[model samples]
Target: MKRAITELFNRLRFKHKLFLSYLIVIIIPIIVLGVYAYKQSEQMLKIQGIGGIEKNVDTISGGINGSIERYNHSVQTIVYNKTFQKIVTNDYRDLVNLSYDLKEYLSPYFTMMTNLDKEIDEIKFYTQTYVPEYGESVQLASRVSEEQWYKEALKGTGSQWFSDNGIIVVSKFPQFSNDKDTNIVYMRINEASLFNNVAALAKDDTVIITDKQGRIIYSNQQASAAADKPVLNTAQLSALKEGVIDFGGAKSYLVKKPVALTDWTIYCIVPAAQLTQNAGSIINATLIIIALCILIVLIIIWIFSKTMLRRVLSLNSLMKRVEIGDLSMRVRSESKDEIGELTNRFGSMLIRLNEVIDELFRNKIVQKEAEFKALQWQMNPHFLYNTLSFINWKALRSDAHDISHVVTTLSKFYRTGLNRGDNIIPVQDELEHVRCYIEIIQTMRENSFDVVYDIDEAVFGYKTINFILQPLAENAIIHGINRKESGRGVLRITAELSGGKVVFTVEDNGNGMPPEAAKTLLESQSSGYGLKNVKERLQLKFGSDYSIVVESEVDQGTRMKIAIPA
Candidate 1:
């Protein structure tokens, strides 16, 4: 058996074996892929088919609904107008008599509705007679004398309605009783006019009109000679349910939405075959190409098997260049289409990826500057503590006990103000710091200034950025209070919390600055100098939402409001 097999193989020509091998490699996968694509294309077709129908339905429905509302407004105007009612009750006038001149009086209004509302086929007018004998000159449709709409109008009910058989209509009931007996009149709107407003989408192949029932009253068909197809059946209609289902032999898709002005359902249908028909053409072309590709693949496999070591070496060199941030690297190719676009996009992505890596490395330096900035804060407070501690200890050794008490209180102030390296301090600690500062100020000059703190204890524990309150306190002292009457410069500080923010106001009973000066001080472009510096730093640390606002009147003292996030 082995001898026979070897002889059979030797008898086959090299070119024949090559072609057969290539066909096995290329043609088999093509057939497999084609089958898969065919299934997917069918599913997509159903969805697109259903979508086209649904979009047309929505367009028509919205347009029709809008036209009904507009027509109702026009008819309502005619319903109450005395002259229009006269045209109905007395005698129907010629088109020209209903106007101001010898020309048609209601020329614009009636013509726009009747002649322009092309979707509507007719607009009916009715008087007191239900027998339909009185209005024969108007050329009435085979008398709707006993129709429900006529009966309803006689009973004084105005009909703004959507009717069966795909009709949308609105009417006005005028019960006019002047000198004699009472008589009712109805101004009927042409159903087609409302439909005409939406005529653009009405003629599409997938048009549908659903009544109050969840069923189709009208569907699309053309003026072909063939007899009309029966619309839909029970088994096919079952696919219109809310979940996915196998449609007819060719898959179908469905969607449901409520019909306008009524409790009706609109079901959209899509056929799967329409979506994926192109895939069949693709499959045939792919089969022919695969037959050619099979010969090429066999030749390549044999050549590569002989020179595997050399090709492997070239691949190693290329990979090494790619590893060390060489993003422009790409394997050369001659073919065109999707594969080429994909390789081009991948090369572009690598270039962008390299740029992002470089950017991240540079941001680390900005992060370092922020760290150095935080360190600067530590040194200033540490200097204040050392100086205050020496003064307090030296005063204790001497007999000046009041001085010692002052220094001790000042030391305690810094301790609470700093609070073991915490960046945020409570409002209570801030208030105590202000009280101690006031004491130190008093020691300098007796009764030279008066300070008051009107702080709410309930709000003391609310959090604020450290030192935020003290700077504003100092601003009022330097710029507001110190410029007052010689004997007593009054400074008042109040702190409260409302709506999840610490709200502080510092006001002084001193001679306020002129409007221009104060405004310039607040409005200057350069910030972070004295009061400006504190405001800028506060904003940078906490953002614009948590910052200070200033308000003042020239003689009425100055008030500053601090809004800091809690």
Candidate 2:
């Protein structure tokens, strides 16, 4: 069977093979997935609807319990009040004194407690003693002693919640009172305040809250008709399990949660068919999507096969042309596949071969021109040196000693600065270069500043870049000593070796600058051939680790230091 299949596949063209392979690999899986999704979507939607209803029931139960707790707290506050208990339990002789205590104290306290929570409609106290009613807030206990809700509150140790006449009542007996003298404090809350918090989450669902005895405390839909009635008859309530149920001949989903600290259960009911209403449309859309994907895959397979064949044929023709010595033609491909890579490699080989042949002839022409330029550059510097020498000789013959001295000093400065076009020189030669610059400056300024060299012998043999110290010396004389008002200024130069590094320091006691001026001296562009040029040259030769730092204070001397690896 395998041999037969292989023989059948080998008989097909390349495009036919690709189309058939894609049909089996891609289209078949999409169809299977679409069928599975169609079958599972109904059950999944039903499960999600039940889960959402369960959360809504829990939130509604929590909101109801919160309202009950708030009313209970207000009752407890009045029950434990010493002043209230004393007033309610006292045996009064005059009715006017009783009315004064009730009107002056108890009325304001009840009003204050009721004002604290917006949910509380009224707060009232029921006393067994005959304390005639002072407003509706103080009532006779005998009036409600025989009532069912009051009897139920007496049976419990703490507060009890009751739904009576569209209002919620929280009743608690006084802590200090005996059974014979029952003082009950009860707070009434409007039922709408408890239901409004969870109503938004229940949207289209019906919620029923029942007490421990299966009596419905509140029903969001049927409350006006069935308040304080049984949630359902015994036979029907037993059949109302969670998940799908047949309620009044319609399929529905039911979720139930118990309220904490209260024996109340909350029920949320939603229709089952309402939850899965869109399942049919989703199944039809899946089938359409599977068909569209198969059509697109087949179309893409055909175009891709045709494009591959055309590019392969073009590459073969180009290779044949290149075999006969034509290197100007180049191949172009936008794809990142194997065929594109092969075409690009072949084009690169032809380009590299042409470049090598052209570079061989160009190198010979450049070498000859460089030699001619070298001969031309050597004459200019020698001509300048000979002219300086002639000026020195004329100065001495004409008896101008100062002119001869200045011309000779200028000659030494240029010669050491040049250094035969070599950047790296001995430390001694760099010192000599700076010394010549200082002498020229002193001659121009008539020896106004004294020079002091604090040299360490160890740094003399080390190598450094030439013409570095000349700018520092020139700045010390021009900006420093020349600007001194009264006394002669002093310039100090120091060289030392420490921790595998060579350090040079230039200090001047002339009219000193502020610290800011000294620090930014190397960064200013106005100083031509100054400290900034020296810093760049040192960094280029010795890497960035070498640099110059400056330190100065107002009315004090300025000191510039250079450090480099030895």
Candidate 3:
């Protein structure tokens, strides 16, 4: 059997083998993960559903308490009223006075209470006084003496709430001055008002309110019925906890809350299947996702294996050509995988081999051509200097000393700037270059700006980048001195060795730019390339540690400084 399996695997194509391997590796774990995720999602939904039901129960309990509170307040009002108590407990000498008192005071008070709180359906007083019962509003205590709610109210010093025969009752029994007069004030609450909020619950959900004795006093299912129906049997009720339970052959989540006024417990029940209904769809989606992932992975394996095989075959063909001494063969690929890497290395090796074989002849020819080019370009700078000298001589012969001086300064500036194409020169030579530039500028502007040199002699021995300060001085005269409104501008050029580093500063007393403009002067091309070029040359010649800085203030002067390592 093992041999047969091996033969089958060996007969399969590379992509097929890759696909099979991936399938075997991922199928079991993906199934397990999908199942686990479904269970966890279902559990989370159950917990959230239970929590939601608990909140609803709390809200329902609050509404019921509010409805009961209003009726209880009415009962207390009638019980504590001195006049109402006196009227109810009064020993009437005649029926006419009793009738007059009821008509004038008692009747109007009850009517006002019922009108003020629409939830109060009726208000009745039960007493055993000799006074005759007027209407249904005034009744004999003996009529309710045997009732459970009445007996309970008589036992407690405070008020009591009772759900009896689809009616909500709040009663207050006050200690009367006459022992024979057991006075009770009763206010019946509108059942609709008591359960108004519970109507928002889901249709399948059920709410049950039970008295302290574990007897159902009210159920939404039997709300209109005269007698309360039992929702759960005795066994189920006894075994109920604040969690999932088996009810009516289906799993239901139950949350219970106690009513503060009556000590009654409110039970909220919802089917577990309803709570986790979405979990089934989620699981189905997860399974579909897993299947898609498997399909995508198989496709990727096939594509990758095919690509690798094609690249390897191409590499083999290139090698065969190379073996036939075709050294110019080349391959280009943008892939960054191992095969691509191998292809790149092979191409580089072939190029290096060809370079080694041809390097000697190539270098000799390049050297000969370079020499010929040098010979062709040797006369340009000398011709420029000679022309400048001839002009200076003609200017001197004509007695134009200023023109001669300007030409001489220009010649010197160009000579120092060239420095035989050397990038580094002595600090003294760089300083002389700046002086030449300033002289030419002053001659052009008719000495509008005066320049002071505070260069330390110690700096003269050090070598520096050529033409570093000339552009800076030019910028100072152009941007600063020329823009000054009043007073002659002064240019101060200073170079010194401080803290083992060379520092150069060019300060001009002219109309300075804003501080922000000064900070970006070396970076903005709109200002000109003079300062920016100097900055780039310094950083490139030295490392990035060397740089230029500018400080300026509006209406004040500007200062440019360059710092470089010695």
The candidate with the higher lDDT, 1 or 3, is 3
lDDT of 3 by residue, 1-566 (tens): 99778667645665676677667656755675666576755565655577777777888888878877766666777778877776777756777777877999899998998788787788888887766788988888898889887888777766777767655565555664546557778777777776767766634577777877677766676542222333564356657897877766778787888998877888787778777665445557567667777676677667756755887999999999999989887766555556667888999899888888679756755664454345334557798799999999999999999999999999998788777766688888889998998999888888877889998999888899776788788888888998999998899999999999989999999889997788677887544337776776676667678878888988898999998787
- Candidate 2 steric clashes: 0
**TM per candidate:** 0.35, 0.39, 0.39
Question: Each candidate: what lDDT?
Answer: 0.58, 0.74, 0.77
The Cα error of candidate 3 at residue 417, in Å, is 99
Cα-based RMSD of the predictions, in order? 20.1, 24.3, 27.7
Candidate 1 lDDT tens digits, 1-566:
99776566445554555565555656665675566566654554444455665676677666756765665666677667676555545443443453332124333445566676555454445444322232222223235556764454444445455453446454554554552322333334454554453335644232345554335544543311133323564344534574343543445545566656544455554444544554435456556656655666666667544443443455456557778747666554222333334445655666687779768855754563454346435557777888878887888888778898788777876777667667567777877876777777677666577888777777866766566566677777777777776546788888777887767888887777776766665456443334555565566667666656777776677887877766
Number of the top lDDT candidate: 3
- TM-score-based ranking: 3, 2, 1
Regions more than 4 Å wrong, model 1? 1-387, 520-529
Candidate 2 backbone collisions, by pair: none
Error of 3 at 275 (Å): 1.8
Over the stretch 140-220, how does candidate 2's per-residue lDDT look in tens digits? 888888887788877887777776765555555564435467777777777777778766777667777777777776666
Lowest summed lDDT window (length 10), candidate 2: 222-231
